[model samples]
Target chain A: MILVAALPQQDILRLLSAQSHPAIYAQASNFSVADSEAILSISHESSFWKRELHFQQLTQAARNAGSYEIGWDGYDAPKPSDDSINQGIALLNKIKEAGLSPSSVLPSADGGIGISFRGQNGRRALLEISNDGSASYAIYGKGHPRLVGEFSPTAANLAVVFNRLSENL
Target chain B: MKPTVQHLSKAPIVEAIIAFALEKPLTDSDAVFEQFYALIQSDYPSRNPVKMAQLTVSDQGSSGETQIVGARFASADGKRVCLVDQSNFICSRLAPYETWESLKSEFERLWKIYSPLCNSRIARVGVRYINKIFLPEGEDMSLTVRTRPEIAEGLPQSMFNFLVRLGVKIPDPQGVLMITEAQLPTERPGFVTAVLDHDLQFRINPESTDVWSLLDKARELKNDYFFASLSEDVIKEYL
Candidate 1:
C-alpha cells in the first residue's frame, strides 16, 4: 500500500530537491554522498536473516512512494524526506547491531519515519525522526507509566531506552 | 566436494579472461589502438580476428562458427586474443587453457605498453574463467552442475535447459563474484556440455596502481568458489 513503484535514480534526486522543508534542506545541502554510502553499506554485503538489511529495504520502498497519489489518509502525509530516512536508517543500524529490530518501519504523517518497538504488557516505544534532523521518542503502556522526550538518536541512548522497555515487558 | 585445489592437471577451463572496463572511452581511440598495436602486434599479429563459437547444428553436426569481434588482435593460432575498443580491454585465452599466472603475466606485460599509450582510467576489473564439462546423456546433471533452479509446486516440473546465476559480494575489498551455471549447446550426441562461468569483478580506484594484487586475489576467490560449487565425483573425473 505504501506506493512501491520504483522511481528512477535521477527522479528520486529531483523529488528530494523539490522538497519544501527549509530546515531539512538547510541541514543537508546535498543527498548524493549520504545516499550512496548509506545505501551501499546496507546493501554491499548482506544475507538473509540480517536484521539491519530489512530496514534498509523498507527505506528504499518508502523512498519510491511516488507512483500513486499517496497521503490520501487526510493528514496530507508526504513521504519521509531524505534527511529523515537517512537518520532513521542510521538509528536502525545501531539498534539492529544490538539485536533489536523494530516491529514496523513506516512513513510518518509529518513527512518523517517512525520505527516502533512493542514489548510485553502493552509497552511500546515509538521513535519518530523528522525531516529537519530532529528525533523524539514516546514510551507508554496500559499499566506502565509514560516516558516521553526528545531523544538523541544514538546507540548508547537507544540501549538505555531498550533497558527500560525490557524491564516493563 | 574438495573445497580447494592448487592447480588441477585437467582443469576444465574453456576460456580465461583478464578484462578491464575503462571509466570512459579513450581520447583519440584510433591513435591509441595504433600505439597498442605496435607493442602487441608481433605476439598477436592478426587484426580484428574472429573467435570460434561451437554451435550444435540442426543436422547433429558440430561446427565452429566465427563471431566477428570488433577491433580484436590475435595470435597466429587464434587461441589468444586481445579485444580492444574505446571503453574495454579484454584479453582472452580460449580452451586448452594454461595457468592463471600465465594470464596475469601476459596482462601485466601488455598492460605496461597499453597503460603508457593511453591514460587508463579503469572503472572495473574482472578475472573470469569459464569451465566446461561434458556429462554422458542420462547422467545426473547435478554431478557436474551443483546449482539448480528452484521452482514452486504446480509449476512445470520439467525443463529443457536452464541457467543459474548467483552474485556474491566480498565485503573486505568490496568486490562481487558472479557465478553462472548453464547447459551449453554441444555437438556430442550422447553428452551434455555444462558451463560453469565464474566472473569476479570489482570497482577500483581509477588511479590505483596495485591492480595485479587485486586480480590475483580475485582469481583465488573465483577458483575457491568454482571448486566449492561442484560435486566430488565431478572433481575426480576432471582430475
Candidate 2:
C-alpha cells in the first residue's frame, strides 16, 4: 500500500461524506472470503479488467518518478484539504499511456476519481487519487473472514478507510 | 389400382399484389411472404421441395426477392416425400411461395398438426414465425414441432450455460443451489423452491453470468431469506 501526505484531510472527508463508495460496504458485508479465495485459486477465473488494472499500476510506477505510500483508514487523518479528483485523473492518464481504461471511477460526482486495483492474495486496493498532484495515494484493504465489517467503506472512519486500504498489499 | 377420388376441389388462391406506390402504408406483404414461404417449404405438399439460398434486396427500401434452390426426396411404404430446406434468418422474409397445388397440400397437412396443439393435452404452443417446413404430397403426413432451449447452439455462452444449469446437477459437487436473479422470487417461487430443494446446486451470478464466481461468495452463505413464489409485488419490490 502506498501512503503519503499528498492528499489533504478535507478531500478524504468529502469523499466519506458524499458516500463516494456507495456499493462497496453492502457488497463487502455480503461477500464471503471463501469465494474470494476460490477465485484466486484459478488464475483464469479472475477478471481481465482486474489483472489489467494491476499490471498497469505496477508497470507505470516503474516508469514514473513518485514514491508509493500505504495509508490505513484507522491510522491516518483526512488530507489537510482533499483534492483527489485531479490526482486520480493524472494517475489515469499515466496508466492510459501504459494501456489501461478503467471501466468506472468512484467519487464520480466529486473531482476525486477512485481507482480500484485487484491485489495479490485476493486482496484489493482502492486508489483515491486527489485531482491534484499535491495529494495522491492508495488505500490497501483487509477484512474479516466473511469480509462483513472488515473492508466496509461506510463503516470506516476516514482515516481507517484510507489506512486499512493501504494495508492491502 | 382405383384412381384416387379427388374429394377436395381446387381452392383457387385469391391473389392480390398490393404495391405501395406513394403512400407509406404498413401492408401484410412481409406477413404474406412469410406465410407463403411456410406453406410451400414446410406445410404444403409438393412434387419437389426447394430451399431458400438468399434474398435479393431491391433498390426500393422495403422491397426484396427470395432465392430458393436445394431439394431432397425420401420414400416410405410405396409413397414418395419431397423435403425442402429453410433457414430462420431475417433475410428469408423476401421470398413468396406461390405454387397453388403444393401450397394447398402443405396447408392441409399443417392444419392437421396445428389443430391438435389447441387441445387440452397440449397446453399452449405459441405460433412462432417458422421460415421453413417440409411438406410431402399425397399420403403419410406428419407435423413436427421444434423448440430451442437456452443451451442450444448459437446462444450466448453466458446465457446458455446459466439457463442449461438450472434445475440440473452442476458438474461439480455442491450444496443446494438456486441459480437465478434475486428479483421477483415470488414470480418464480416454484423455480426457486425446486432449486433450493435440489441436492446439487450452483448459481449463475446475477450481475454477470460469465463471472460465475462473482456472486458465489454471497449466495452460498446461510441466511433465512424468504422463498416466495414470483408475483407483481416481488417485481416491484426488487425494482
Best by lDDT: 1
Q: What tens digits encode model 1's per-residue C-alpha lDDT throughout B110-218?
A: 7778877768677778777877776665554544556656556667544445555555566657876656565543325666656677777777898897787888888
Off by over 4 Å in 2: A1-87, A99-103, A108-111, A131-133, A143-169, B1-239
lDDT of predicted model 1: 0.63
DockQ of every predicted complex = 0.01, 0.01
Per-model TM-score, in order, reads 0.52, 0.16
Q: Grade the docking of candidate 1.
A: incorrect
Which 10 consecutive positions of candidate 1 chain B have the poorest summed lDDT? B156-165
Best by TM-score: 1
Q: CA lDDT of B1 in candidate 1?
A: 42
Could you list the iRMS of every candidate? 17.2, 29.1
